[model samples]
Target: MLSRNRAAAARSMPGEGQRSSGRAAQRLLVALLGAAVGAAVAQADEPILPIPPAPALDARKLALGQALFHDKRLSNDNTLSCASCHDLSRGGVDGRSSSIGIGGAKGPINAPTVFNSSLNFRQFWDGRAASLEEQAAGPVHNPLEMGSNWAEVLGKLSRDAPLVEQFKAAYPDGLQSRNIQDAIATFERSLTTPNARIDRYLRGDKSALSPDELRGYQLFKAFGCVACHQGVNVGGNMFQTFGVMGDYFTRRGSVTAADLGRYNVTRNDADRYAFKVPSLRNVAVTAPYFHDGSARTLNEAVDVMFKYQLGRSAAAQDKELIVKFLHTLTGEYQGRSLQQADPLVARRP
Candidate 1:
């Protein structure tokens, strides 16, 4: 969370931007993390974990993850990466209901925003992967996604001495295959999207957001969308069947494996068609919506949610107000400076 790395790190707080270093230090952190995990397990209660301070973004891991994220070479046909589907400038999604991927395989779901995803309770449309570290490993090997084997990725990266050097500088254990994942994961954790005007307003600054956005917020709650999509990561903490007031699965038709959603992960018939309520922070940008990318516009998605879930229809003004409010959710990210700025990553040596 160094000031220089966060880019928008400055706020009204003191001691807000400092970087922690070394394997031993991180190991101490890991021990605490394990204890916290155990404590939560014992309680069987779900509490929001405080978002950790963004990890250091120096000239090492940041650079590596940045390269890996943007490098299409990670795909089998030299086609995609975490960035291909989730473009940073494009509100962290490719703006398709689903993007074309390796071997031109159409992804079964929409690419969720990478921004502030470190805050999500889980990864993917189903609440899976409990940590950002585990989530970071996903696309690298998904057959229809990047489609690259980690072993092959490791072999390719192992020959790059410069990448190895960057890894050593950023990771305490340095350059092992798993550590490469660690570096990329660490860099991704450092990627937090915050400081929206609405956040400031919610924090007590009355003038931070516009009147339209404020109206939108009210309509959001009154419509009871908050019942399923609430809490810090906004919506990632919970799961709900797609068509709750009515049968969404039956309506979807020609049901693909993707329609099974959480049921696919749990093997429970009751869980069928349940998907994680996605964070709507950047909804204005990431489009062709829904888990299956079935909705094409932000307004359309909002209308569908109202009709199917809330069992109400929004007035034109309310719909416009909500769209205005959604625009505030796009926090700024401009090709973030990485912990490492290695030429190898930039050049793909």
Candidate 2:
């Protein structure tokens, strides 16, 4: 009887061991499936893309546009040019909270950088202009901007024999307002800055980013910034409310017409405070950020995004890392680093 019992016990032990092994295998399979699902979620959530260089353009047209862009004669008082608001040497922005326009007039909104603007689906913070051509026509006639009618601008341009000759060379129809807009728009399209370190990293150059930058990028993705700020230009392709999680205007106080954002164009309450997401390319130098330019520094801008747009609190280290990642977005303009040519003028209190 004892021998029989030992034999049964030995057989049961092998069976029990087999069941245990099967359970271990099942757990392993479940873990692998979970890992795969997690990877898919991450990929779906964060899709980073590199910004390609601008396409080649006609040299004569590009030159003509650059001249027009810098020519102050476009303004009513001959005191400002496109360059006055968008300083090409300074990340394509004047580094002011609000642009100073004709007759020392202050613009209602911040001047977004012209660099890579061609990639945007629409122009302006409110997405009022459907194309760069339409956008070019805006400031020229805006009362606070260039403050000049198209007729006055054409009259001024027609007087310059060299400019007229160049215009004729560039456009078959010559220097009409439409042609001028076309030329300026074409030049603005050429103002793209490529070869950013972050772009290189996206293009599979692992060494392009440092350890901190890589971690910062991961954090940027993890924190859900990429939800709005994604794609080639990184945020220009869409519009989002300024404060998704909180009332930015109420917090800041003294809301202006500019704060209305896309509401001015749509006249819909739902569109209130909706603004075209500005591209993050060269954002480090385009300080005094947002439609109002309330955030003074990159760090402050990140903090505001977390508090208002993201509706979350982030550790100081995370914010610093995110800022470091943003710095990597600065790129080269015609083989040279795109940086502010001068220190930003102090904003008025």
The candidate 2 region of ten consecutive residues with least summed lDDT is 340-349
TM-score of 1: 0.76
lDDT of 1 by residue, 1-349 (tens): 5866566655433442333345557889999999778765643332222223455566566778777677666677776777787777666677677667788788777778777787777888876777766776778888888788777777777788887777778778776656666666666776676655555555446686788888887777677877876665567877888888777667778898888889988999988999988987656666667888777667777878887888777688998787777666555454332121111121110
TM-score of 2: 0.85
Off by over 4 Å in 1: 1-59, 334-349
Write the residue-wise lDDT of candidate 2 on 74-192 in tens digits: 99999999998888877888878898887788889889999999999999999999999999999999999999999999998898999899988988888899988988998998888
Q: What is the lDDT of residue 17 in candidate 2?
A: 73
Residue pairs with colliding backbones in model 2 are none
User: Using TM-score as the measure, which candidate wins?
Assistant: 2
- Please give the lDDT score at residue 127 for candidate 1: 69
Q: How badly does each model clash, as a count of residue pairs?
A: 6, 0
Off by over 4 Å in 2: 1-46, 340-349
Q: What is the lDDT of residue 167 in candidate 1?
A: 76
- lDDT measured at residue 299 in model 1 versus the true structure, 0 to 100: 74
What lDDT is reached at residue 273 by model 1? 90
